[model samples]
Target: MSALLAASRASLRASKAPVMALRRSVHIENTVDNVLPFKAGKHNKGKVAVGVTAFFVTGLSLPLVAGLWQLYVPIAHARSK
Candidate 1:
């Protein structure tokens, strides 16, 4: 009966040590709900819109330019003959 009590105490201590270590190792932060609140900005919004428009326009125009060049090359070759 004494050995069983001692074993139970040892197991309890072993389980509690890990719980204490985990509690100490955890880091709690003061988090806020509005970390970055959205605000209207005409200048910045215009710049971002222009940048996105330019990006998509350049992306789409490159393929169109390439296709046009391909068509022009065949037409020019046929005209040269």
Candidate 2:
């Protein structure tokens, strides 16, 4: 019978080994060590420039604020009188 032949073919096919998929792993590298301490102290200059700018800003603004407060006191006293 055709059913019996199909059963025998299915049984024969099951005796072969199962297939497995294989893959190669991807490689990665760290880049931080190579980039630090940049050329000719230019990177350090950027940091120093920021610090200098902050120092100048703070130094100049304090006197300006004190002068403003000094000017405000006279006007406030006049208004109160």
lDDT by residue for model 2 over 1-81, one digit each (tens)? 999999989988775545532344744443643343333254476776787799999999999999999999999999999
State candidate 2's TM-score: 0.41
Local distance difference test, each candidate: 0.75, 0.73
Alpha-carbon RMSD to native, per candidate:
12.2, 18.0
Residue runs of model 2 more than 4 Å from their true location after superposition: 1-40
lDDT of 1 by residue, 1-81 (tens): 999999999999888785556566645443442222332255467766877799999999999999999999999999999
Candidate 1 residue pairs in clash (backbone atoms < 3 Å): none
**How far out, in Å, is residue 54 in model 2?**
1.1
Runs of candidate 1 with Cα error greater than 4 angstroms are: 1-43
Worst 10 residues of 1 by lDDT: 31-40
TM-score of 1: 0.46
The per-residue C-alpha lDDT of model 1 at residue 29 equals 49
